[model samples]
Target: MKNITILLILLTLTFSNVSAQKIKDGETVSLNGLSVTFNITNKESVTVGGKNFDRYKVSANLVNNSEKSFNIRLNASPQVASNTNLVELDCINATGAKLTSKKMELKLKAHNLNATYWYYNKEGKYVSGVLPVIAGYYLDPGDSVNNNAIFIVPQGETPDVLLRKI
Candidate 1:
């Protein structure tokens, strides 16, 4: 019985360490009975096409926390920001407000025999010009995906992102 107690304590501590690896901001949302959260880390700004934009490095984590494997379709839009301030980074917004969708467009393509996806954006009306916004992810139980995106918002405005089941 003493040995069993020791094993249990070790297991508990192991789990605790795993959970502590990431910071939780209480930004959980329930999608089709699954617990999901989006975290924005490492935000910055850059000038593109004579204008400044907000860029974000983001991650979307889907936790099953259940007995069954769920087949889910997650729509993770990189260019779209959530209406909440959950994923805001401490970066200066050069635009002063969020850029409208018309001012920018998400450019994504699959490479390596369609094994990987690349993300970039075109600023202004010119096709030869490109900005940076890495956005692409899918959903799987106990899986996390990364997306980085640039928003057309000025400083002090954070883009809102959302996840939906389809």
Candidate 2:
């Protein structure tokens, strides 16, 4: 099962990278000397825990095309509401009436979780990015990091910001 899962993930990354290479314009952004490609391969909605949520699957590929090692920070920007801790889901149900959910907060927790995405170390081997308590990480020369994130957006009055980049 572990091997199958790894194979599936590798396939996903391979396909995503192929799509990333077809960007026409601003999808590729440069920071210092690193070339980061952001691609949104899928966008839709899903029902989780009886609530409607918009889903955005994004793949952020960071390539240290330069010769130096650099510490990179993936800052959660206000302009990108998808990266926030509290994602507002759609308040209305199928019939259009608003849902009166109780006032409750939920926190997600994980322990010793294996890395799911793809990254390359200084030795060029596939690995995972250093998981920080916050956003951001480091990149070494010839290293490539594929950072994938799924944004669960609430349905209703559309959010102030959508997942504009992949």
Candidate 3:
């Protein structure tokens, strides 16, 4: 029975769809009218007005594939996943308040450039900028921007952001 179970597990893993495979670092996922490439980087903490902050940052390169201005229609919330399980980290506000959501979404309007998006700079502060993947920011067609999305993951836990399509 043990040997049969092991063989079954192997067969299941081998027969899984290619789309179920995890998107590794430096890989790009394209959907709808946008494409995203991900890379996780160490948090570079910075102090502002005597308060220090650090975060686990994931930088994503976003490309617009439409001929005109594009509005964000995809759910851009990222998940931290491991080999065995996928973890959902708590969503925190700028004032350090915990929220009920574990997912983040982006809602950019068409032709709206210079809009402040939710970007956590390398300095570790939650500020609005053009370099944000999970917020409202306009991207002209054929244009790409390296957006920074930071998470408030706990210390000592190395997290892998996973993008899975259902």
Which candidate has the highest lDDT of all?
3
> What digit string (tens of lDDT, one per residue) describes model 2 on residues 117-165?
6788889999866443433334468777554444454664222222122
TM per candidate: 0.38, 0.35, 0.37
Per-residue lDDT for 27-128 in model 1, tens only?
A: 776644555565656668766677766655555555554445433222453344222111222222323344523111111221111223444545434234
**Residue 154 accuracy (lDDT) in model 2:** 68
Residue 80 of model 2: what lDDT?
Answer: 23
Better of 2 and 3 by lDDT: 3
Q: Each model's C-alpha lDDT?
A: 0.43, 0.45, 0.49
How many clashing residue pairs, candidate 3? Answer: 0
Q: Which residues of candidate 2, in runs, are more than 4 Å off?
A: 1-26, 48-51, 71-138, 156-166
Top candidate on TM-score is: 1
Give candidate 1 misplaced runs (Cα > 4 Å).
1-26, 71-152
What lDDT tens digits, residue by residue, belong to model 3 across residues 1-166? Answer: 9999999999889668423323345787776666666666766554444555445566656677867774443334443211211111223332231321233233343332344578778989988766434333355788776545565444444334555422
